[model samples]
Target: MPGALAAVSDPALRAAFREWILRVADDELVIGHRHSEWTGFGPDLESDVAMSSIAQEEIGHARAFYEQIAADEGSDVDRLAFDRAPAEYRHAALLERPNGGWEFSILRLLLYEQFEAARLGLLAASGQEPVASLARTLVREERYHSLFARTWLERLARADAEGRARVQAALDSAWPDALGLFEATPADGVLRAAGILGEAPEAQRPAWEEAVRPVLQGCGLSIPAGPAREGGRRGLHGPEFEEMLAQMTEVWRSDPEARW
Candidate 1:
C-alpha cells in the first residue's frame, strides 16, 4: 500500500487512510471478540485450544495495527478500541452478529479467514512498508488460522445430517453479509490512487467470491444469495451489533481516562 499511501499528505487521502484503518480495526476487533466467546465452550479439547489461539491472534493483530496508527495521533490503542460507542464501530454486521453455536462460529471463521488471507496478501504487496510489513507478518499467522478452519470444515462437512445441516446453514447465513467486508468508501479511490490497494477495493469482491465459492460448493453448500447488507463501514449496525457494543465497552467506557 506504499503507492496507496504515497498521496496520504492530501486531507482526503489521509481521511481515507484512517477510515480504511478503522474498518480493518473493526473487523478484527469484533470477530476476535466473537470468537473469544468460545474460550472454554468448544466441543472438544483440541478445538478449544485452537479457537482460543485464533481469538488471541485476532485481538493481538487489532492491537498491533491500532498501535501503528495511534502513535501518529499521540494517543494509545485501547481508547480507539473499547472506549468507542457501538455506533462508532466500523465492523461488518456479519461479524457482530451473535455466534449461534460452535459450528456457526467455525463457519464464520471458514468464510472470513479466507477473505482475510486475500486482503492481507493485497496489503503485503501494497507499496507501504511498516504497515505492509505488518500485513505480511499477519498473513503468515492467518494462513494457520485458515488451515484450522478448513480442517474443521472438512470434518464437519462429512459429519452426520444434523451436523452438516447446522454447518451448512451457518455458511448460508454468513455468505451474503461476508460481501459486506468489501463495501467501498471514498477512501477506496484514495487507496487505489495511492497504490495501497491493488485496484479499486470494490474490484476485489467478485474475485473473492470466485476464489472461495468452490470451498462452499465442495461442502455441498451454496452461497446465500441475498441482498447485500451495508452500513458497518460507516458505523451503521444492527440490533445484534448494539448488544455487542454495549457489552464490549462496559469495562473501559466506565473510566475511559483511567490508566489500566
Candidate 2:
C-alpha cells in the first residue's frame, strides 16, 4: 500500500490529493446507498436484481477507495465512511437528492456514469500508482454501469410519449445537480499543478456535456438552463442527507465499539 501510493512530499499537495480521493469515494458511497434503496422496489424482477448488483458494485468501489485512503492516513475505513460529520462529506449534491422515480434514478445514473467514466479515464491515464491501477479496474465496471443506464434510458424514451415525458422531466430536474458534479474546488488546481489530476473538474465539463448531449437530445430531452446547484463539494448537502446519514450510520453508531 505504501509503495502503491507514491509519497507526495509537499504537505499541501498531499492534503489536496486526499481531498480529491475523498470526494470520489463519497460520491460512490452516497450514490450506492441511494441505488440500494431500489433493491426490492424496481419496476420488474430482472431490473431489481440488476440494479441491486450495480448498487453492490458501487458500494464495493467506495469501500476500495476508502480502504486506500484509510491506509494512507492511518485511519479506519469504517470511521472514514460513517463517522464524518454530514457537512464534511465531499460528494456532489446530485447524489444526495432522493430517488424520486424510476425515470429520475435512471437519468441520474446515466449522467453520473458518464462523468465518472471520463473522470476515471483521466485518472487511469495520469500514471499515478495504486490509484491509476484502481481507476483502470473500476472503469471496467463503470462501462457496464454506463451501458445499463443507457439501455434503460433508450427503452423508456422510445416506449411512448408518456415514457419520454417522464424521462424529460427527470432530466430537466436533475440537470442543475448534474452540472454540480463538475463544480471546481481549490484542491482541483492543486491536484492539476501536481500532475496528480489529469484535468481540472471544470475543464472536463465540456467533454462531459458533449458526451451526453446527443443521447439526451435523441431521447427528446432538453438540458435545462440554470446555474449549477453548488454546496455538496463544500460539504453542504440537502435535508434528505440528514435522514440518509441517520439510517446509514444507525447500525454502526449503535455499536461503535462492538466487534462483528
Candidate 3:
C-alpha cells in the first residue's frame, strides 16, 4: 500500500484517493447485503420489489468496484467478498446497523443513495479513465437508486403522524455515520497529486456535506452534528457485519469445491 502511495508525488492526495474509492466499495457491499434481507419480506409487494431492486443494484455496484481491484491484482472477487473475515471489511458502521423498521430501512436507503450519488460523481471525473468509466456507469444505476430513495422518503415523511416521526427518528440515528463517510486516510494527498482522483477528502468532504444538507432539509429532516464515528474505512465495522457475513456465505461454504 505504501508503495502505491509512493508512486504519487504527494502523501495526502494519494491517501484521499484510496480512502474514497475503498470506502465507496465497502459501503456498497455492506449495505447491499443488509438490504437484501428484505427480498421477500418488506412492508408490501411493491415495496419488496423496490427494495430488492435497490439491494441488487447496490451489490452489483460493489461487484463492479471489487472486480476492478481484483482484476488489477489477479485476485478473485467472490473470495474477496464472501470469504473474508469481518475485520477485513472496510464498510462503515452505518451500513451494518440493523434494519429496525421498514420506514427506518427506507430512510437509511435514502441517505445512503444520496451519499453514493455524490461519491460516484466525483469519481466519474477523476481523470483515471478506467476507474472514471466505472464511476460513469455506476452513476446510471445510482440515478435509479436516488429516485427510489426520494420517492420513499417524501412519501413516508408526509404520510401520517407516526410515519413522519419514524422517518425523522431514523434520520437522527443515521446522521452521525452519514458524516463518517468523509473520513480521511493517509493517501488523500497522493491521489490528487498523481491526478488519479479529482479532490482530496478535505476538499470533497465539505462540498459533499453542503450538497447533501439541502436534500435532507428539503425532505423535512435535520442534519446531524457530531464528531463522526469512523473506522469503516480502516476495516473497522459493527457487529452486524459478522452475522451478515455468515448468512451471505452460508450456502457457498457448505460445499467449498462443489460445482453448481
Number of the top-ranking candidate, with TM-score as the measure: 2
Candidates sorted by lDDT, best first: 2, 1, 3
List runs of model 3 lying over 4 Å from the truth. Answer: 1-21
Question: Against the correct fold, how does model 3 do in TM-score?
Answer: 0.87
* Candidate 1 error regions (>4 Å): 1-7
Question: 37-86, model 2: which lDDT tens digit per residue?
Answer: 99999999999999999999999999988887888778778999999889
lDDT of 3 by residue, 106-148 (tens): 7777777777777787777766556677888888887777778
Q: Write the per-residue lDDT of candidate 1 for residues 125-198, one digit (tens) a residue.
A: 87666767888888888888878887888788778888778888888778768888887777788778877778
Model 1 CA lDDT for position 247: 85
Worst 10 residues of 3 by lDDT: 1-10
Which segments of candidate 2 are over 4 A away from where they belong?
3-6
By lDDT, the better pick of 2 and 3 is 2
TM-score list, all predictions = 0.92, 0.96, 0.87
Each candidate: what lDDT?
Answer: 0.79, 0.89, 0.74
User: Once model 1 is optimally superposed onto the true structure by TM-score, how far is the C-alpha of residue 48 displaced, in angstroms?
Assistant: 1.1
